[model samples]
Target chain A: MPTDTADPRYDYALRPPRLPQPVDESLASAPIDLDVRLEMYRKLHLLRQWSKRAHDLFLQNLVKGTTHLSLGQEAVAAAFSSAMRPDDYTFATYRGHAHSLSRGMDPGEALAELLGRKNGVLGGKGGSMHLTDVTRGMMGSYAIIGAHLCIANGAAWSAQMRGTGQVAVCFFGDGTTNIGAFHEALNMAKIWNLPVVFVCENNLYMEYTPIDLVTAVPRPAADRAPAYGLEPIVVDGNDPDAVYLVAREAIERARRGEGPSLIEAQTYRHGGHSRADPGKYRPQSEVEAWKARDPIPMYHDRLLKLGTPEATLTGIERQVAEVVDAATEFAKNGPEPGLEDLLVNVWADGGAEWRN
Target chain B: MAELSYREAVAYGIAQEMRRDPRLVMLGEDIAAAGGVFKTTVGLLEEFGPDRVRDTPISEQAIIGAAMGAAMTGIPVIAELMFSDFIAVTWDMIANEIAKTRYMTNGQVTLPLVIRTANGGGVRFGAQHSQSVENWCMMIPGLKVVAPATPTDVVGLMAASVRDPDPVIFFEHKALMATSEEIPDGEIVDTLGTARIRREGTDLTIAALAAMVPRALEAAEMLAADGISAEVIDVRSLVPLDTRTILQSVAKTGRFYTVEENPRVLGWGAELVSIVSHEAFWDLDGPCVRITTPHIPLPAASSLEDLAIPSVQKIYETVKRTIGGAP
Candidate 1:
C-alpha cells in the first residue's frame, strides 16, 4: 500500500479500504426525511458537475483565470453548508467554488465570477481566487495561504463580543497547517473560546507535493487539536452521510458556545492543483485509486441502495446539467465592467482627499 | 477657561467620547491598570470597566488586529500603541487591513478606528522611541493623520478623529504631553481639516505641526522684535491638509517657512514646501525655507537630542533668512 512510486497499482492499494459497511446507522436512526436527503444529494451533484465544467473550461481557455477545482471534495462543502445556518459566516481558500456555490451563491454569478465577467459576485474584481459575496455571508476566498484563518477568527471574535449566535467556519488545505497565522488563529480561538470551526480538507497533496513530504505530523491535520485544547474529528470525506453527521455535531457545538472544533476531512482532489497543472507528479495509479472512492459515484450508489429510484437519480443529474448550462450561458452574455468602476469604491465621499 | 496639559486633554476627550457612545472602547499595553505608560488612560478602566477599557498583551499586531475586528463590527476603537515607533510592528494591519478595508469593501464598510501614539525627540528617549512617523500614515489613503499641538486642539482633534468615518493615526508629541494651555470648556472643536493662525504677521508664513507649533509661535515673537513680521499656522491635520489656507497665507506673505520635528529630507516640511511652491509660486519672493531635525536619529543625551530636533532658535533663524534678515 506504499505510495512511494509512480506505479498506479501500488497507489490504488495505498488508499484506505472502503468502510466494511455503512457506519451511520446511529445517525440514520434519527430518520431524516427522504426529501431532504435527495435535495442535499442533488445540490452536491450540482457542485460536482459545475466544478467539472470549470475544469474543462479552464483547459479549453474559455475561462480566463486558473481554477482550484474541488472535483473529489464536494461532500464536505455540501454537508457543512446543509448543517450551518444562513447567517453563519464562512471563509474558504482559493479552491472555493464548491464552498461558495453551496453557501447559496447564484450559480450564474459563480460561473460569471470564474469566467472573470462583469457580472461576477465581485464585479470581476475578484476572479477565481477571490470570490466574495459578503451579502450571502461568504466572507471571501483568499489567495494568501493562511491569512483567512485570522480573518475568520476576527469575525468570530466580533460575533462573540456582539453576543451573536452565528459561528464562523474557515476552510483551508493541509498546507495552511504549516503557517504561523494558522497557529496564531487557533491559539486565539481556543483562548477566547470563540465560536469557529476550522475545517481542513486534507486532499493529501499541497499543490504538487504530497502532505507526507510537507507536513511533520503523520496523523490527520486535525489530530493536532489536543495541543490547541480542542477535540478533533476525522471522517470519511467521500461519504456524504458521514460528513453530514460530523458537520452537524460540530456546527451545533459551535452554536452552543462550546468553542471551536477542528474537523479534518480525509479527501483527495481528482484533478490537478489548478487548471495549469496536469498532475503529472502524482502517479496514474494513485489518481485511479482515488477515483474508485470518488464521492459522486459512491454517493450515487449509496442513494440507490437506500431506496432512491434510478429515475430520480437521472432526474437530479439532468437538473444539475441544466443549471450549469444556464449559468454558463448567463456568463457568456454577461457585460464587462466599465472603466469607471475601477475608480469607484476606493474611498468614502469625504475621504477622497487622500486619493488626490 | 481652565489650564490643562495635552495628555490630560486627550484623556478627557476620550472619557467624554466614551461617555457619549457606549460602543466606544480602548485597548493598548499597560493602558488599563497602569493607566498607560504615559498615564493618559488613568482611571478609564475603573470608570468604564474591563470590557470598555482593556489592557492587551504586548503584541502590537494583536492589539491593532483586535481593534480592527471590533471596529469592523460597528465599535469605534481607540487603540494606543504607546510610542509611534512601535507602530511598525502592526503596520500590516494598519496599512493593509484597517486603512484599506473601507475602500476595498467599496465604501459599504467604514472603519472608525483611532490609533493614538506619542512621537517627538525632546524627551531623550533615543532613536528607537522618539521618531515622528506621522508621514508614514500620511502616505496611506483611507487614513486621516492628525497631529495636535495645543491642549484644546488635542481634545477637539481627538473627538473629531473618533467620529471620523475612516481610520485615523492621531499623533501626540511626547514632549507636549506635559505642556499646559488654557482650554475652553463645554465646547467641542469639530473642524479637523482646517488650520488655525496662532500668530498673524505679513513678512513670512510659518506652518508647523505637533510640538513645533509652540516653537513657531516663540520664533514669531522673536522675529516681531526685529521688525520681521512672522505669521504662525498650526497644521492640525496632515491627510486632509488645509491647502487653501496655506496657499492663501503664502500668496499674501510671499515667504514660507515649514517646521517639523522629523528629519529634514522628505519630511512633512518638504511636502509642505512643495505644496506651497506649486500653489503659490508666482507670489514667492524667496525660496521656501524649512526648519527640521538633522538627517540622523535622535541621540540618547538630552543635549544631543535638543541639537537633533528643530528648536525655537532654529525656526527663528529659518524665518529670518527667508525674510532677508539673516545679515
Candidate 2:
C-alpha cells in the first residue's frame, strides 16, 4: 500500500504521448524565487486542508447546494494561478474553489458565498459554482462544463483589442475537451491567435466514469490540440513546479499574442465529483498511488529535501493554518444579504433593466 | 434625410456605432469578407478593418459565447447568425450562459452585446433555415428582444441594442431587408419598449411585428377601402414590450389584433394577448385576435409556405372579423 514510488504492477494511466510523473526531478525546479516557491507551497497546503474542512461542512449539512472540491488537484490550481498576473482574467469550472482562492478571492468571501452569506463575494448569488471577483480578474465560475472556454477566449480577445497584452486562463476538466464548446472555442482561439491558455485538469476520471469511456481521445486531452493548430504541453499536474513552468511559458506566449496553448495537467482528485458521493469507482490501488503523490505532502517533502529549516517549515505551516481558521470564522460569521439586494447591479442606474 | 433600404440601414447603423465607439466590433460567418448573406453588413469590414469586423467559423455557440466574454471585458460585440432557425442549436449559450450570467452573478457582470439574426420564414429557406421564434427568446429573463419593422427602426433599435447595458437579441426579418424607406440618415434612437404608430384609425388596433408590420399597413389600406378604419402599431421591441402604446391604441380603437409568422399556439402573440387582458381587459370591446402560422414544421415549397404564413389578407380579415363580432 506504500506508494512511495511508481509500482510497475499498477497502471499510472500510461498511454502514448505519456505525461510526466509527479516525481519527475527535471520538472521540479521551476525557476521560481525560493521565497515565492515556498509561499505557493503554503497556498497549496491551505487548499489541501480547506477542501477537507469544506467536505466536512458538507457532511454536516451546513454547506448549501452541491460542492465540488479540488482536494488532490491543488498543484495545478496553485501553480497556474501563481504564474498569472492580477490583470489576467481566469474562467473556472464547477470544481473551482481553489482556482478562485489562487486568484486572490479571500477564502472567507469564497466560503461565505458557498454558505450564501451577504458579505460573500457576489453577495451570495453565485454559490461555489459561479464564484466571481471581477475586479481581481476572476471573470466568473461556470457550472456548465466546457462552457467558459469560449468566454475565456472572448476575454483574451478583449485584451488583444485593448492592446493590454493581458492573458485569459481557462481551468476546465479533462471531460470538457470533448464538449462542442471546447472544440469551437479552441478552434476560434487558434484561428484568431487569441491570448488564452487552456489548462485541462486531467484528473483521470470524468465524474464517476473514466474519461476513455466518454471521449474518443486519450487522457490529458491535449493530444488533440495539434489538430486545432495549438501546441499541447503535457505536464505533471501534481508537481507545482512542473505545472508552474509550463503555465508560465504558455501565459507568456499568450501575452505576446502568439495564440493559445493547451496544458493537460495530469493530476487526480482524491474526492468524489461532489460532496455527496465517495469516489468508489476508482481502483483502491490507483487511489492510494495518487494519494501518495498528493500535492501538499509531496511539495512539503521536496521543500524539506531542499534543506529548509524545520522551524521555518513549521512557522509557514502555522501561518497557513491561522489564515484558514480565520477564513472559516469569517465565512461563518458573515451576514446574510437583505431583501433589497435581490436585484442590485442588474442594470445601469439600477432602474429595472431586464424586468426579472 | 436620405432614404435607405433595410439592408443599407443595418450596415449604416453598425458603421456609425463602430466609428463612435472603438470598443464596438462584429463577427459572424461571412460577415467580414463576404459582407453577410443578407448584405446588411456589406461595407462594415472594409470600413472598420478586419480586427473590428471578424468572420468566424460555422460555430453559433462560440460566436455568442465569445461575444458574452467580450461584453463582460468592456468590448461590446455584434454577433450575427446567418439564419434565425439556428437559434435552436445555440439556445443553450443564449439561454443558459448569456441570459443567466448577470442575475446569477448578482449583477457583478453586464453583457453589453447584441445578437443580430435574420428571422421569419418568407424566403422559402425551409424549416431548418427559417423561423420567427422570438417568443423562445421572450421566455428568458435578463435578455432584451427587439424586432425592427423598417429601415429606420432597424438602424435606431440596433444603435439602442449596442448601447444597452444588458444583452439584446436583434431579430431582423429576411422579407423586409430589401424594403426601402426614408430613414433619417445616422439617427441613433436608443430606446426600448416604445412602439411606432404607422397609420392611425378608429375602429381597431392592429399590432404587428417585423415583416407583419408592412403587411398590416397594406391590410389597413384594404380595410380603409371597406370603411373599417384600422390603427396600425408596430410592436417594434418585443421584450420590455411597448405595452403603454399598444394599450392606449387598443383603448382608442376598442379592438386588438396581432399578426406574426410563428405558430399560433403559445406564440409571441399569446404573450401580447395575456398582457392586453391583464392591463387593458376593461378597455377591450371584444376578444383579442392573433393571426399566426400553424404548429406544423414549415414546408419547403413556396406555395405550401404561402398557405401557412400570415399575410396582409389574413390580417385584414382577422381584424374585420374581430371588430365585426364586437358590439
Candidate 3:
C-alpha cells in the first residue's frame, strides 16, 4: 500500500531509512551513514514528542480509557523500525504507541484514535490500547499480555509457508515471559523454525510491580530463550545504536530461516505504567537514575559525538515538534464517530446483526 | 453421491477446502501423522503435506492464536481444538483476540478461519472432555458458531466455514462421529446462517443442534407413532441463527421445544427461545420448554451420562407430556 502520496514527508519510498546492509553482517564494523543516523534521530524525536503529547491528551480528558505510553522506550521502537523491512510484520503490546508510529502510522490518525474520533486509525473503535494499521504491517496493539506472542508466530508461519521473507517482530514487556502464551509461542516458533524476532522491552516494571520481584528468572525473556533452543540476546533498549544492531541481526536471522530469537532489551518507562499510575512505588533515587539515561538526549549526544552538526540535530527536533503540533490539532478538531459506527465492523459485511 | 461417516465427512470437508484454497492451513495437537485424536482429520497430512497440515504442540493458545494470526495475514486457517472443553485454556485467543480483532480494528483485519472441535459426549469421556460449549461461541459477537448434526452437514458446513469471511466455530458432535449418511457429489458448500428442516409437521416444532438433532428426529418419529405431528429443525448455525426458519416453524406448529446437549443454564436454546418468544409471540399457543442436560459436569458412567444428557426417550416424553397426544 502506498502511503501519503500527497505528502512526500510520510512517503517511505521517497526517503527510506538506511539500515545495516545484508552484506555487512557485523554491526560492530558496519558504517552507518550520517543520513541514516539523522533518520534514526528524527524517529526518536518523533516518538518521544508524540508519546508526551498523547500523555497530555490523556491528562486533558480527551483520550478516553487508559493510554499506555512508551515514554522512555523510544530507542527499541526506532531501532527496530529502521532495521525492519517495509513488508515485515510488527505485533506490539498495549505499550505500543512508539511501535505504531515507527511503522509510519500517521501521527494525526494515531492521536485521533486515542481521542476516539471517526478519522482515527480504527475509526474510534479501537481506542488508545489498540492502535492498528494493517496496511503498514502494524498488525495490532494487543492489550492481553501474552496473546500476540503466539499470534506473531502464526504470521511468521504464514510468511514461511508463502516463502515471503517477511519477519514478524513481536514486542512485549519483561513480565510477559511468565504468561503461558509466551512460552507456548516461543516453543512453537523454535520447533517450526519460524521467521520471527521476539523483542522484550524490559521496562524494569510490569504494570505496578518491579518485574524481578515476581519473576523467577533474572532476565525475563533472554534467560528463558535457552529452553526454547534460542540464544539469550540482551541489548540496551535505551540505546538506539545498540538496539538497532541487535534488531538487524535477529531480523536477518529470522528472514534467513534461522528460526526465532529472544532479545531482552533493558529499558525504563519514564512515566507510570499508564495514566492512572503516579509511580510513587518507585524510589526517587531509582527514578532519577533512569531519567538521567533518557534515550532521546542520549541519542542526540551520540550523533554529536559522531561529527553530526548541532544545527542538524536541532533541525530534526524542530521538524518533529511541528509534526506533533499538527497531529494534536488535527486530533483535537477531529469529529466523533456517528452512532451508526457502533453497528458496523462486527462482521465482514459491516453489520453487527447476527440473525435476520 | 457417496455415504460418509461423520468423521470421514470432517476429513473430506477439510480436504475439499484445502484443495481449493492454497492459503488454507490446519493446526492442532496429534492432528497430523496421528490422524487426530478423534480421527476426524485422517488424510489431511498426507494430502496437504507437512507445510499446511502440521501438528502443533498441546498449546491450545498457540494453535488458536496462530490461526488468528495466519487469518489476519490472508492465510485462512482451520485450527482444531481436539475437544471443545479445551476452549477454556485458549479462551483469551478465541474470545478476545480472534472474535474482537476485526471489530476492534474496524474491519481492517477479517479472520477467515475455522476452529473445529469434537464436542459433546455419549461414549463416556468424562466431564472435561464431554462438553457442548457452542453456546459459549454463540454469545461472542464476531464468531459464527455452527454444530452440524449429520455427515452431510459436516461436509457442507465445513466448506461454508472455510469459505466465509469470518471466524467460525465448527462443533462436530463426538457421538455423531460414527453416524454415516450419503453426501452429495462434488463440493458441498452450505450457507452459514440457515436452518435445515429435517422433518416437517404442524402440531409442534422441536429445534435441536448437533447430537441433539438425532435425538429430536428420533423423538419426532416416536411422536408420529403417537399421532402427534412434530417438526424437527436442525439448527446448524448458532450465531447467525436461523431465527426466520425457527419462527416460521413455531408459527405453523404453535408450540416449540428445544433439544440441547448443553447444560440447562444459558444454553443456545435460551437465546433462540427468547428470540422466538418475542418475534413469534402471537403464533405460539403455549410456553416454550427446553430439554437439556442438567447444569452439572457430565459423568463418566454411561448410565448416568445417558440420564444426564437428553435422550431419545426424554425428548419423546417431553413433547408427549407437554402437548399431550396418544394414538
Deviation of model 3 at B183, angstroms:
1.6
TM-score of chain B of 3: 0.98
Interface RMSD, prediction 2: 2.3
Candidate rank order under lDDT = 3, 2, 1
For each candidate, the alpha-carbon lDDT, in order, equals 0.80, 0.84, 0.89
Distance from true location, Cα of B105 in model 2, Å: 1.5
Chain A, model 3: TM: 0.91
The model with the greatest lDDT is: 3
For all candidates, what are the clash counts?
1, 0, 0
TM-score of each: 0.86, 0.94, 0.95
* lDDT (tens digit, per residue) of candidate 3 on A1-356: 55536432433223322121121123333466667667888999899999889888877888889988888889899989999999999999988899999999999999999999999999999998898999999999999999999999999999998998999999999989889999999999999999999999998777877677679988899889999998999887877777887888899999898999999988888788889888765666666777878878777777776678899888889999999999999999999999889899999999998997
lDDT of 2: 0.84
Q: Pick by DockQ: which candidate is best?
A: 3
lDDT of 1 by residue, B3-81 (tens): 9888888888899899988878888889999988887888899999987887765667656766776566567889899
TM-score of 1: 0.86
Model 2: per-residue Cα lDDT over A1-356, one tens digit each: 64565543343332222223549765456477777678678779778777777777776676889999999899998988888998999899988889888888888888888888987887887788898889889998898877699889889999999999999999999988888889899899998999999999988888877787678767546788888987767888898888888888999998987989988988888888887768766667677788888888778877877777768778888887888788888988988888788867655545454421
What docking grade applies to model 2? medium
Query: Which has the better TM-score: candidate 1, or candidate 2?
Result: 2
